[model samples]
Target: MNKTICSVPAKIMRNVVLLLTLLFLTGCWDRQELTEMGIVTGIALDMNKETGEYILTSQFLRPASQSTVAPTPNEPFILISATGKTIPELMQKTNRNVDRNGFYPHNKVIIMSEEVAKSGVLHLFENFQREQNIRSYAWLAVAKGTSARSLLEKHKTSISSIPASFLNNLFMDANADAVSSNLLNFYKKALKKGESPVIAVLSIDEGVEMTPQTTKLSGGAVFDGDRLAGFLNERETMAYNWVKTKIRNETLGSYDFLSEDGSIVALALIDKNAKINPNVSKGSLDSFSIEVNLLTELSEHQPMKEFNENADIIHYLDNIEKQAEKKMKADIRHLTETAQKELESDILGFGDRLYKRYPSVWNKVKDNWRAHFKDLEIEVEVNVKIKNSGLIKGTLLPESM
Candidate 1:
């Protein structure tokens, strides 16, 4: 009757619950700290021919030393290397030599030796995809005729304090086409039936020590399936960009040509759109047509005769537009021929366009898309308009030569 129930007190139960909660609050088991971990901002992969091993080069940031020092000529970042038979093994081996666990979330770029890329990057990607720390947006590039290790070496300042940031800046330049070589992006495109993958080409100037601006990211490395097929030069790259996207800033690199008036001239593209349309006839792949509209401004017009009147300006503009159109078409044609005949890869998303417009036709050629894309007839038409002529125009010949 005294209610001697065999029950625990509320106070004891509260204490038990608190102790269990405390056990679970031991923090993330795998969480790494910045000070205790090597903050990797860039990574490069290479293959050693003699040893037949995979080489991993990692760039670690030392911000504490950089800002606190007198800014001597020492590298702000430290590069470490390790070799293994595979990418995952290589990474594990590399970590053994490092003072701390190599953290990759901050990695801005991944450079691969040409040999590594040609052999196929699927294994490399496979390991990275499984890691939570790896970034999807980190750029991927192929080093031409050089070890990826050489590129990561601190030979010179590439403008940025760290080489990794410099690599990021090189690819992210506004004047550039704004395309990323991020592995995730490449993988997505590769999986698409009508699209192939392309990564940026990183070339270093061997003439002198590479300045921050010395490393060039002008062209692209095209891939067939998962293996690299070949490369596209700067001009062809520009053309490919045009065919693939609308101008973000409309600025193509400077163009110089001989004007119709027998004078040297130069122009800068400001903005435009490159549109591709695939036409099918009778449910079969027929042809692809491209229409581009461009707005250009005169950068330099060294006319033999001055623009003394508005009509002269009109005449010069017309001649320049025609010349520009011709050059543009030529570039596009060269790119098309190379992709079709030489590379035998569909760098252009033409197949994707075809699939969208003509799904039935796409199904027929989807398996052998590159073959059909190469054989598909294509036409291009470019229209350029000159809208500006600088702050003031004319020759400095004292008004009467």
Candidate 2:
């Protein structure tokens, strides 16, 4: 009787184990196949100022017939648009009409038109923030002088079949003409810290007859708490990059000097360092001082004067360095002044820096930081070092020769 009872228990335990094993053998119930999803490479958001409705445009990647990776002359994307009161609503409506589910993990860019950027953008970001499929590192841009959807539709490429890839490649250069930022950092700056954010500007270049239109990335859209305040030209954008220490080696810089016979010197940035110091007096924020140092290689010297001696070469470079410093300082000053006087936006993060060093003072002014920023005095100092001139120290053909 004891052996029979033990056998019954063992059989029950075996059956339970077998049932658990069968549960583990089941396949994923919600797995989506590659063919069942449409890969979105780019998204453009715009607002109808009159109706206040949101217009969402998405670029879906269409794989090449033969080779998916090879560059093709034909455009490999289709533009789909939807309209609704909110971004999420528009996204849902778009999905209802599309054959394949919209997959957004591979998205490379999001462009907001001027209308939407100027009115406000916080609502649009909330949808993107809540969506887990969208990548946080995808670049953000503001469409300039055109609708976001039109820019997306007009964007043509020869480098790669996907225009989004071309757009991503445009921002990869160290000498990028505009500020580069992503959704995560940008949203954090605006929402978390209550700081201003700047996004790169995208514009379409209508090609000449028989030529294809191309896209251009230049300048930046400066925002004051998620609303477009103003714009930063290419020079100002470079200055902004310098202050933020975003500049990298091999980046190009050029400036013109009237004293040097109206000559223009081109330079390649070799290295850079920046120091932003905030002045606080008696628990009160007073001013800020920014010092930037740059080591640069002389890429082009417009003055064709040859240096006959070492002393002459040294003098030439020293004068050029001073002019470079002056040019850079002017650009930086212009950007700061615009931020304070015109835009009333702190794109340079002066207030944020102050908060880090003296939280007490920042707390007092955080509510009205823009007012303080408008009046706050900032001193800009730039020191440029020309380490070497490429190939030749001076011009090959001299006037005397």
Candidate 3:
């Protein structure tokens, strides 16, 4: 009985020690409350001519005070701009001015103005690369015709709780024709070899009366190495998407086909796939053969022609498929030819393909690939299948039929 009592006293002493330790470690030393930190939703980068410094703009979130009351006609975000030679210095200045410490972990978008991009985004990229606290996958785009700050100011009313959440949703819900851009991938391509960086384009457009302005995200900005080379239209971007981007997974591309009487038919592109083959002859790069195949459904047709029978319908579908194939082939050709002739750069990533598929040939030409790419020849073939006619099965009885 004496031994049992002694053991109980020892156990009680151990429990007391554990409780004291837990008490000591209860609160975090670097604890930060949600209300205390100003969450950054978006960032815009530009160049300041007068200051000869970088213009860094940040969009900070201001959540509603009461859940039931509608937020005062005030915007859900506050946009701030500070000019500094470097990002670190700019951020330090920003911290001193803002009411709360700015947090970037929740950032949604990064916009680089066309002028800033042309000058070289190396410094901006370095900061993003070095930062460990924030997401590396913020949706990156280049703003055309206006400042990045202007675009951010206009890109609102997304209906998400936080500004960051709104931008993330906006990008996710955006049309799939353009490939999404992120910091890491863009920089990796900019720093390394073989491929060029292409960023989605954002531009401000006039909205309805109440909204006043809106942002358009389409097309793309192409970089020859690290410098902004040229802009690609939507058609050109579609061609690039087929060869190098994620278009096949998400978008049902549309094409216009001219009818016999000068009218048009609209077909929706679907289930597309591509195969590229590189040929070499006599120890010199010969040519590249690209084959593209896709399925399409007819959405709208002109009133010019009426299909009289099943054979006529088949003929019409066949003709539509042929036109689509031709259009895709022409588009790919134009993109490659432009890459080779006008841009004089391999933005199509043929060098990387050559490196992978034909390492031996690449080893010989990798150093001078850009020069060779300009003069390189290519053969393209596109095959399209008309899947359906969308609801209208047969011809409307013309009363003559």
For each candidate in the order shown, give its overall lDDT on alpha carbons: 0.78, 0.80, 0.77
- TM-scores of all predicted structures: 0.89, 0.91, 0.87
Tens-place lDDT per residue, model 1, 374-397, is: 787989999988888663445656
Worst 10 residues of 3 by lDDT: 154-163
Off by over 4 Å in 3: 1-29, 69-73, 155-170, 207-212, 248-250, 391-401
Q: Rank the candidates by TM-score, best first.
A: 2, 1, 3
User: In candidate 2, what are the lDDT values of residues 1-401, reduced to their tens digit?
Assistant: 99998999899999999999999899999788998998898999988788989898998876663255785666668888998988778878888767787888899989999888888888777877787678899999999988888766635464665677777877665253577788887887888453588888988878899988778788888998888888988878888888884654356444434545686677777678898889988988778999999888887766556656888878878888888898889889998998889888888889888888888888999988767888988999999998877545456775486
lDDT of 3 by residue, 1-401 (tens): 99998999899999999999998788888889998898888888888867668888888877763246776656667888888988888787777778988888778788888888888887667776687545778888888888888866634554554444555565675554565678777877888567788887887777877875666777878887767888888888878777766553444567776765576888777667887778878766799888878777787876635656778778777877777778778999999988888777677677878888878889998888788888888999988887888635555558675
Structural RMSD, model 3? 3.8
- Highest TM-score model number: 2
Between candidates 2 and 3, the one scoring higher on lDDT is 2
TM-score, prediction 2: 0.91
- Flag the better candidate by TM-score, 1 or 3: 1
Query: CA shift at 58, candidate 2, in angstroms?
Result: 1.0
